[model samples]
Target: MHPSIPGTTPDTSSTTARSHPKHLKRFIIGSVAVLSITGLVAGGAFAVQSAADSRERVAATRALTDSTGLQRDQLGAYAGIAEAHTDKTASSTLAEANQVLASTEGKADASALTAVSSSLASFESMPIDLVVELTIETQTETAALSAAAAEADRVAAEAAAEAAAAAEAARQATLATTNTPAGAKAFAQSLASSNYGWGSDQFSCLNQLWQKESNWNYQAYNSSGATGIPQALPGSKMASAGNDWATNAATQVTWGLGYIKESRYGTPCAAWAHSQANNWY
Candidate 1:
């Protein structure tokens, strides 16, 4: 109005100021969008980290649980053996038993660890539990032999024991005998220490057969055609004990025991019956 211009008007300054308001609004929108994207990215990273931590915790828990289970099983077995002491504390057998307890306390596979638990002193203890069980049922049968021993007859005891030993030797001599290796007898004893259920019937039957088979000889062997302690018809079968099945009692015992467990369910009487029926154990 003061100086009327053809192209410009008094309202031009107002329009320019309004344009600044729109630009300010656009800037605010862009800042908000950037902030939203940043927040989303941070939240996603946090979620991933939390998930990884949770998985790690889960794995740790599983490992702890497995270790605890093995420890408990081994502990219970050791406790059972510790409760049943029949000999002097200083006996080598007792020492080996203690060693077995100590060895089994650590983490390891059960079967492989069987060889690390015992010593030669514990070999006789292997059949102690088994003998106890058998004596209960078949004590009458051994009564003549026991009576013979008690009558000032170390001769009878020796003869009977020798006979039993001979039978074992015979059996072992024929088949793939115990394949555990001589050094492993102690280890087997450790496992035997845990075997609270081993019985006399098993002992008697085993004695009767194995004495005739291997004469208590761990390394005794029959001809290749004859095969291990129980003398399986085919020598090849004793390989279940080890590749050197023909020479090892551990391998033989493992396989023979498996057969008894599977076919006879560890009943020595059943094994005896089968032996009687088949003429081959």
Candidate 2:
């Protein structure tokens, strides 16, 4: 049982009631589209962030690998030097670095890789410094050994030179004691008897022959360029007997006796007879 109102339409109530479901449906659809777009945007941002992180990780890992390779090469070089020099400290340091590098293998995180790379770089310097120290020590020892060897050689040379000088001095002292005129004549007499089988008569003739020529003086020099007890025409001729011909009476007597024995006379007595006739013999 309804009653009529004024002229405000009853159709308005029905139309308004019907439009609410349409408006509500449109609002629901618009809200669903906005939520879908927001989700897509959020998902895209997450994917972009994930890809960037992967690139960073890859870059870091590559850097770590390259650095590790360089470190390994350096480590190998240092190990060789250490082994050659027998440096225990440097070898130990390299071993520790090797363990650290081994620990970093297969790591993939960016932060972890960068950290390990830094640690490795720092570790490399320690072994290098140790190797340098070892090299310096080895060089120092080598130089010291060389210096000691040179000193030893110098001392040995001086000792040898001193010994030679002492021997020469002893020879000169002996010559001074036994090279007088009387000593020269006695030596000649003994040599003539023993070597030439000449008797006292031969020695007496040899003595007279030499006395006339140079008076048995070992240092005798003649104006005819003759010298020594033998009075050879050239003083250098006496070098056949001994290097000390100018000063040694025994050398001069030996040469003179040989000349008398081997000459055309072949005997001291014959040589004396010839000298007595001529001024020179």
Candidate 3:
């Protein structure tokens, strides 16, 4: 054993100093590991925050774009609804175009709105009233023309009907004349010769007169009470010839010849001349 010296802590401090290096190394290593872990956790947290921020920014941008699209779509729908008016109020078209311009608001750019406004102005500047009036006038004129054409067609149809009726009447007259009895001419000739002293020269005149009056039909009747081949006024006047005057051509001819000879018309030719001038003998 060694005796202690006063006021001297001896070399104990040196031994402690030599031993402290290992503890210091261990503490530094532990501190470095803790700092590394803290750095890694901070980096991960920063990355997560950045990603969240980026997503939020994208969502915000998309929301803004969608809002703009919705605004534009609503504007277009309003414009479409306003554009379907016509008739006498054609100026409503300009009103609708103006509405389209008003609907653009914040959704469209200034240039786009200006273009739409210009179009509306141009539409409003046009003479819509004049166009409507002109259209009405044109329609009126067209209707007048159509009516005139229809009238012309009606007139043409009426004229054609009248002509057809006249032709049918002429055909009936011809048929009646062709149906004359074979003995009618001979009977007329015999009666004219015996009673009126008329020869073959008067035969033609008698034939023309009888044909014009009754188509040589003994039973023929006229609206004026005239009847038989001579178309005598009052069919009963032919009864002087015979009771069968209406049915017999010979009886009708005998009575007619006697009447011509006794009256102012002394011959068939004179009676025919009178009939030609006055449509009656």
Candidate 4:
């Protein structure tokens, strides 16, 4: 109203100035409340994040501890297996190998054992496989030696049997010549018939001839150094027939017959005729 402009109103300057102070105070209080609420929310968020991080750390530590325990258990299992292997080898194979070695000839006798003591004393230090191989080789050698010994014995037995048979043959060969005069004639008669295709007449002639000389005594000897039933001159000459020619009548008779045949007196009758004429044949 006091000189107002065309479209302007009058100002309440004093009233506005009085209300502005109250408004500015309220605004300042509200801003402080909002800032306190915001601070409380941020603090709660930080606490929750910290708790989650701590739980994550705890889970990671547990996982690492479990992994370490599993690794330790595996190592223990490997160690136990190695220990079992050592025990088994020591108890069974090693013991058996030692026992076998102890039974060997080189270790059996006290005197023989000393020769191999150095090796045997430290034999356990050798590897188990090597010990086992050596044991097998030794056993095989022992078996071979036993077989050789047995074979030698068998051969010796066979030779002894052959020698015995030869001796028996020599004894039987002289059986007829060792008989008494009457028995000699009977045996000669049988031999003449079977071997010489002669009859009793040839044996009778031979008996008479030998009776005049030695009476068929296998051990007959003469002052002229003659020996045996055939009275071979130079008694040692009968050795050509047999080493026992002096005692073996058949050996002497066989030699005498061979001599007669070579001298063209092929039969006992022929030898007797020649002997009768010359008193010796």
Candidate 5:
């Protein structure tokens, strides 16, 4: 049995309220823990800032390089970070990096230096470590590409040279074994009788003196400037036949016929190819 109060009716609700109070106390403890955690986190961040501010630029660079040094890519990244800090004098990050890379010497580690330069070149924008890795990879690839292109160019140039030499040799051989003026008459006569191309027209006017003197001597130079079988006064007048017209009959005939055609249409039927092929008429 319960003991009864003297005046107020005994309130059973008070017991219920007391029972819930423990849960409220637990919530207060949890809030306090969250506040403590937040304070610790903020304090830690301040400490890190103070530590960073205490180091010199060179020391900072060394630290970065040391941390990432073990990683193939990370070392390069650290090197870049060092470079970025190296240019303390420059206004921009990259400019500052440039300054360090330029001024750092015996104290500077070459591998680290290279990594810094390589990484810096690769970045449009990025953290120093990643920039360095990108730079190293890109430089290696670019060098390889350049070497391949140079090799290809060398091969192409050699082939072109060989081709030019072959063409020159053939041209010299043609000149060495060309038909003489004496041979021209017999060849022309035979061709004339046997439908000598182009309507078999009479080139008799051109054939008159050539039959006796040069006989179609393309190399017939009077050195005195009397040139070709037709022997035009100036010798150079027959140059239309070939650039070697003065020394080559094939050249002279080419020029003579060209003169006749351009000045006289096809009435004489002098063609550049026919003259070269048959030697003359």
Candidate 6:
């Protein structure tokens, strides 16, 4: 209550004080709204970033799965070749790779996938060298076997030729002793027994038959065109036994025995009986 100055008569201190509180309340509400909007925007950005990270992880897992499948297929093909060659080292590596692939199946862990991929890379080239070596070895073994077979065949052919020459010389030596008439008779007896399966009893019949035909003489010839020890229809007919049929008693005897056995007589005794009955057998 002092004397009024020029234009200061009102005392509105209480009103100013009340208005200050209202302004404070409005400022508080606006600040709260601004903070709420900022929180929503921040949350939305974080959620979008999180979703993007999840998509990247899914793509990485898919890529890893594809890579692992391709690696497994290549390893399986190599393993088949290794097994065919009976290579134990390559087989072991393939087994280890399969185990690693099995452990990482359907997994999305990046570290596990990386480990498996690394293992596969390390194992990939291991079987290649072994396969190449095995292929070379197989080819070499095949060549050696072929060479050995050819050599064996050559040796067998040489041995067969030598045996044939030895057999021919022995036959020539035996025929040289049959030039005389007594030796020719003895050779005929031996030939009838060994070649015709005829014993002494059948030999008696064969001897009588040939003696009547040619006097057991390989040089005998008939005016009717029969010749040789057994009186073959033609002298050259005994050439079936040897080229020296006219002179070799063994040759003529061999042909005579075969003729008696083959001409439906079956034995020299049977031929003798037929000759006695028909006079032409």
Best by TM-score: 2
- Model 1 over residues 1-281: C-alpha lDDT tens digits? 23433332222122222223322221111111101110122212321223333344345434543755634235334434532432232243334444444544432223322333223234334433332333332323233333433453565677899999999889666443334333333333333334425555455665665556655455565666666655665767877667866666666666665666667445555667766888655
lDDT of 2 by residue, 40-68 (tens): 22212321223333344345434544755
lDDT of 4 at 53: 34
Ranking by lDDT: 2, 6, 3, 4, 5, 1
Output the lDDT of residue 166, model 4. 99
Top candidate when judged by lDDT against the true structure: 2
Runs in model 5 deviating more than 4 A are: 1-122, 182-197, 203-205, 222-224, 262-281
Per-model C-alpha lDDT, please?
A: 0.45, 0.60, 0.57, 0.53, 0.46, 0.59
Q: Write the per-residue lDDT of candidate 3 for residues 111-163, one digit (tens) a residue.
A: 43344334334432333333344334444433444455466668879999999
Worst 10 residues of 2 by lDDT: 30-39
Runs of candidate 4 with Cα error greater than 4 angstroms are 1-131, 134-137, 140-179
Question: Native-vs-model 2 lDDT?
Answer: 0.60
Question: How accurate locally is residue 150 in candidate 1, as Cα lDDT from 0 to 100?
Answer: 47
The lowest-lDDT stretch of 10 consecutive residues in candidate 1 is 30-39
State model 3's lDDT: 0.57
For residue 33, give model 2's deviation from the true position in Å.
63
lDDT of 5 by residue, 32-107 (tens): 1101010112212321112222233224435544754553345444444555553231224345344444544333
105: Cα error in model 5, Å: 38
In Å, residue 26's CA in model 6 sits off its true spot by: 76
TM-score per candidate: 0.30, 0.48, 0.36, 0.43, 0.47, 0.40
Better of 4 and 5 by TM-score: 5
Clashing pairs in 4: 174-250
Q: Write the per-residue lDDT of candidate 4 for residues 139-170, one digit (tens) a residue.
A: 44444444554666688799999999999888
RMSD of 2: 27.4
Better of 5 and 6 by lDDT: 6
Q: TM-score of predicted model 1?
A: 0.30
